[model samples]
Each structure stands twice: as C-alpha cells, then as structure tokens.
Target: MPRFAANLSMLYNEHDFLDRFAAAARDGFKAVEYLFPYAWGAADIARRLADHGLQQVLFNAPPGNWDAGERGIACLPGREAEFRAGFSQALEYAQALGCPRIHVMAGLAPAGADRAMLQKTYESNLAWAADLAAKSGRDVLIEPINTRDIPGFFLNRQDDAHGVITRVGSTNLKVQMDLYHCQIVEGDVAMKIRKWLPTGQVGHIQIAGVPMRHEPDLGELNYAYLFDVIDEVSTQSGWTGWIGCEYRPSRAAQPGATSSGLGWLAQRLQ
Candidate 1:
C-alpha cells in the first residue's frame, strides 16, 4: 500500500499540539508533514515521533508572516539573507529529526517585481537550498501555493515550480505539488501527477477536499480513486513517497489544536 501522511500543521488543532502524533498514529498514518516546527524544537518532535512510530514526510522552514498570508520566502527579493539563515537552521532541524524532506518557502512576490527577475531569484534560491540538502544527504521540496486561497503568494503553479527546479537542475531539489492548490489553480490533478512523475519533478504530494480544504473524503477531489491511481503508479515504477493530508476540520473550526480526533485519518488511509 502507498503510505499516507497527515499535515500536522493544520491537524495540530484537531489533536492538540502535544498529541497530534498519537492522533495521527491512531488514524493509521505513519508519516506526516507540517508548515513549520521551529517553535516545537527538533528534539521534542523527534522524541514524540519515535514514541509513536511516526515520521515527518516533510516540514518547512519558518516562512515569514504566515499569519499575514505569507507562505514562504524562496522567491522574495532582498530576502535571500533571510532564506539562507532560515533554511540553514531548517537543515539542522531536519537532520536532527531524521526527516528526509524539507520544503523551501518561496515567499510572495515583491511589490511590482519583474517576472523574469523573480524567476531568476527563485532559481538562485533553489540552487542554494539544493547544495545544503546535498551535503546533508536530504531532499528539499519547493511548493506552489494556490492564489485563490492564498492571495499575493508567488510560486502558485506546478509549471512554475518545475521550471525553477529544472533551471536549478538538481536532483536534491524538486516540486512539492499540493493537490488542493492544483485543483484550484490547474483543475487537472491526475494528469498533472502523471506528467510530472516521470520527470521526477514532483517531489512531494499533499491532499485535501476542494472548495473547503478539509478531509480528503469531504470534498470532490476523488482521493479514494486518486489513491488508486497512485497505487498503480507505485506498482509500475515503485514510487512510494508520502502523500500529506493538509486540511481543516470544517465543523470544529477550533484550529484542531486539541481535538485528539486526527488519528482517524490514519485509520482511513488504505
């Protein structure tokens, strides 16, 4: 079976931060991803995961202004210093936690920025990140956030992600395709998956219900069937990477900070 992972950053509320691992453990998932974990400390999370037999499929270095709608800093100009400092620490954190994947935050576009310049900036940033990852023997993923839900963020499309990585031309760097974002931006999920899977550009995958970004079963993303497709791909090519569940609980809107109910997702994974 293709292993599935939860997005602990959003699921943190559903199980309370402390027990998110246990909730994911119960839900039948052995791996997961999160937006950031600097506040939680590396050792603490690693210990918790060890206790629960869980692994971090991916985790991002702290992105600037997540609350103000900023997702990452990979494309932000004049922020190269920030990206370097932040990612350096993230490498240490990932190494300590034994996480193989780290998502580089490609922050929002600068005010009145030139497209070509922004593209160059992104390419340079990925090269820098890839070098660090290579030395550490870890993989790094760059993500594209959907503009519909996350307005003002740059790097919102799979093509953009692929272009940046291709320019950098490093195996240590690849695209982190968030399905929820793709469904919103491109609308064709499975075909895109196949298109990028062969190039090895699609490094990581995240799933959520459309229209609401909730559980995979809640929206019309067809995750059950999608997983079937993923299974087929895995069989033909032996591609067994993590699929992160990054969604919110609609009814409980309580930030899922303390629900302890997230483990059900693990159980739901086939």
Candidate 2:
C-alpha cells in the first residue's frame, strides 16, 4: 500500500499552522509535509509532531526572498553563499524534527542565460548538499517543477533530474517526483513511475489533480489506478516512501473543507 502524508501547507487551512498537525492527525494521517517550517521554531513543531504522533516526512529548504518571487537559488550562480547558509539552517531543523528528506528547489533561469553554466552550478551545489547531508544520514532532493506552475524553473523533466543526480554522483541525493507536474510537463506518468521507482533514485512522490491542483480525485489523472500502479511497482522494487497529498481544497471557505474533501483517501484506505 502507498503511504499518504498530508501536506499541511495546502491542507487544513481552516486551522492555524501549528494547529494543522492535529487536524491531519485527526484525519488519520501518520505523516505530514509542507513547503517550509522556518516560521515556527523547530522545538515547537517537534512538540506538535510528538503530541500528534505524526512523522515529518518532507519540507523545502528556504527559497530566496519568497515575497519577492524567487522560487529557489540552487541553480543561480551568485547566490551560492546564501543557498548554503539557508540549507544549513534547513539541516538543523531536519535534525531536530527527525525528517529524512529535504527538497531543494531549482530556481528560475535567467533569460538568455548560459544553460551549461547554470547546470554546472546546480550540480556543484547539489553535490555539496548531498555530501553535507550524508554525514547526518539525511537525503537531499531535487524536484522537476512544471513551467506552467513555475515558469523558468531550472529543473522541469525527469530525465534532466536523473541526469543531474548521476553527474552529481551522490547516493544521498534523490529526486522528489511530483506527478501533477509530471503530467503537465510530460504525459505517461505510470511509465515514468515504473522506469524510475526501480532505479532506487526516487526519494519521494507527490500528487494533486492536474490543471486545477485540487484533490487527487478531482481532475484528469485517475489516482486510484495510479495508486495501484504504485503498489505493484513498490511490491516488486522494495520501494517504501510516502506519497504526499499536495493540493488545494476545492471548497476553500468551508470549515473542515480539507477533511470533507478526503473521501478519495478514505475510499483508498478501504
């Protein structure tokens, strides 16, 4: 069976950020993930996790000046120092929270920029992150985000993600595969899952309804069938990882809207 982790960042918006942990636990989620945990102290978040008995599965390293619209700085050349400092802070939180994986966003590409130079910088940064994280038995992840959702994102294809992982040459480095983005950027998500899961390089997976970014059952992709595919592939490959429920609630204004939209998850659990 595929383990599901509620993405607290997107779900349970009716509650305060710290309160979302209890909401997810009330919904029977054993694990949780989010965009970032910087706003709250690690000890505070850790207390919530312990109280709720939910494990922290994944979260992003700080993206530079999110208010100013920077997605990430890993692929940018001049921001290496900033990226290192931010990622180091992320590691401290991961250690405190006992989270195994961290996703490092590949920042947007500059217009008419040198693609080769950008890639070199990206690989160098990732290699360093992997090496640093490996000492602590933690994995560093790179994700291929869709251009439609995040235009000019430096990483946007599975092959490109794997290529970078290969060149970086670190076992601690892995890809965070978001099927929603995969469907938008390239069709045939099942085939991609089959091909990549067995490689042992895919560290985590995320899902949402395509086009709308709503519940898994709301859009084009048939998640039930995909879940079965994941089960089958996982059974054969010995791949055990959490599938993050990263989506927006269709009914945003209603109290318990997030929990009410969880019928798909309930059906699957049966």
Over the stretch 169-201, how does candidate 1's per-residue lDDT look in tens digits? 898897888889998988888888777776767
Model 2, residue 30: distance off in Å is 0.3
At residue 4, give the lDDT of candidate 1.
73
Q: State model 2's lDDT.
A: 0.96
Model 2 residue runs over 4 Å out of place are none
Model 2, span 10-74: residue lDDT tens:
99999999999999999999999999999999999999999999999999999999999999999
lDDT score, candidate 1, position 46? 89
In order, what lDDT does every prediction score?
A: 0.78, 0.96
Model 2: colliding residue pairs:
none
